[model samples]
Target: MSKYFKKADLILFIIILALSVLGFILLRKPASDNAQIEISIGGEVTEVHNLDTDAEYIIETEHGYNTIQVKSGQVRVISADCPNKDCLNFGAISKEGQIILCLPHKLAVRIIGGEEGLDAVSY
Candidate 1:
């Protein structure tokens, strides 16, 4: 061939670069430092916690009990009396949109503004 790199190759490279930059912008995640945690029990909002400070919280509902620990702008379920320790094993989450769910206890712990994916309109 006369050319080692054709015009098609250059066009393809430009297309890939453009797509990568667009993808990065579209999927950019929210910062977790200013995020908040939402605790939902039995489909109701039980508590809200700010990630700026460290604290410990005990949750007791008609279903069961759970102990939540927050430190260094991260949150996790440390202890739970539920039969399964699934929620406790979720570990610490310092990212937006992370979640810990306790099915038997009907509890859901999630961080707001931490989703690292495209939103509804973008999706």
Candidate 2:
């Protein structure tokens, strides 16, 4: 029984070490530098003249209102008229699958990136 236990422990340690090394390798890889597109629910598309300027756009929906800001090379929600203010607290999300939801406004903000052109992002 003791021999079997020792072998099992060794196997577990080897597996853990392998996983740690794999994780480190993955973490060392460079991140993707893709341009992000901003979409607003029930809002019209407008061109921002000044790329260096920081501006906020207000979006009003049936549920509530939200303030979106464009800064640096990204866009994010700065504030919202929701009760919990959770949407505003989300700060910014640049990766795929990351989303900002304002239940009051029935609004959702997401990042979409790919090789092909985006046809549309559905709820």
Q: Which ten residues in a row have the lowest lDDT in candidate 2?
A: 44-53
lDDT of each residue in 1-123, candidate 2, tens digit only: 474578778899899999988876653332234434445554543322222345677877677778877676445788777898988878865554455777666667655444343335432
Give stretches of model 2 more than 4 Å off: 1-34, 38-55, 114-123
- CA lDDT, every prediction? 0.81, 0.61
Global lDDT for candidate 1? Answer: 0.81
Q: Write the per-residue lDDT of candidate 1 for residues 4-123, one digit (tens) a residue.
A: 888888899899999998876664455454577889997899888887669998999888899999888878999999998999889987766667899999999887863345455475
Please name the candidate that would achieve the greatest lDDT relative to the true structure: 1
Give per-residue lDDT, candidate 1, residue 2. Answer: 41
Evaluated at residue 96, the lDDT of candidate 1 is 68
Off by over 4 Å in 1: 1-30, 114-123
